[model samples]
Target: GDVCVNTLKQDWSPTHGIRHILMVIRCLLIEPFPESALNEEASRLLMEDFEEYARRAKLMTSIHAASASSASKKKATPLSVDVANHLVASSPKSSKKEK
Candidate 1:
């Protein structure tokens, strides 16, 4: 995924490459491929039916924004639970090591 982002930054050096890259990125954002995916499912959805894909993308974006806002409200300060757990588990053990 990071490599793909880097690839997008590079010059396409070919006609219509920019357009194709944009299409692919759009697909990746909505329907990410964590595994080895030849092409993203979102792109196929878009190519098959643009209208439906756009509608769903818009809805998802709105829902994501709302959830982000909700989460932001719940977080009031620093020192997360993960940090506390790490500090507790990472202490030295007072035990002799056996060879």
Candidate 2:
């Protein structure tokens, strides 16, 4: 697959407040409310036994983290003014002929 490069200056920020994000994180890890579940099956399984859920979650998290870290290592260069200038400077200019 061809590596994709971002060609813009991005804000790349979350709209929601950090407190809300923190609260949700707490709900997920420390005190998961299974009855009011976002994922019913997983939540039910979690309610059955935390250790079981933790074992599966740990394995999945480790697998995901490994992939993500590897991908992050090959960080793509983003297009900028300097890059655009370099591209223009490098491209061959066509010669014009007058009749």
Candidate 3:
């Protein structure tokens, strides 16, 4: 079950706080509900070949982890003041006059 679509949106309640939400997410990860799966192919693979599914999941996790580490190492350069000002000035909202 999807956290956003199933839990947060559909099964959302005042009683279900952050802790409850987290627990639900944890449960889903531990034991996935294939019936309401967003990715049918993954669900099918998981159902058909558990070993293959596990292997692919591990591979994807490692790939993502490597990319994430590399991304963290690269610092984002801040936009120059001149470019920021130009962007603001060029916006459609900036062109509109309020009478």
Per-prediction TM-score to the true structure, in the order listed: 0.31, 0.40, 0.58
lDDT of each: 0.55, 0.53, 0.69
> Residue 17's C-alpha lDDT in candidate 3?
55
What is the C-alpha local distance difference test score of candidate 1?
0.55
Better of 2 and 3 by TM-score: 3
* Model 2 Cα lDDT, one tens digit per residue, 3-91: 11111114224543444444555555576556756666667779897888889888878866657668789956443223223322222
**What is the lDDT ranking, best to worst?**
3, 1, 2
lDDT of 3 by residue, 2-55 (tens): 443477677778766555666788898888887777888788989999898889
Error of 2 at 62 (Å): 1.9
Rank the models by TM-score, top first: 3, 2, 1
Lowest lDDT block of 10, candidate 3: 80-89
Q: Which segments of candidate 2 are over 4 A away from where they belong?
A: 1-21, 24-28, 66-99
The candidate that achieves the highest TM-score relative to the unseen native structure: 3
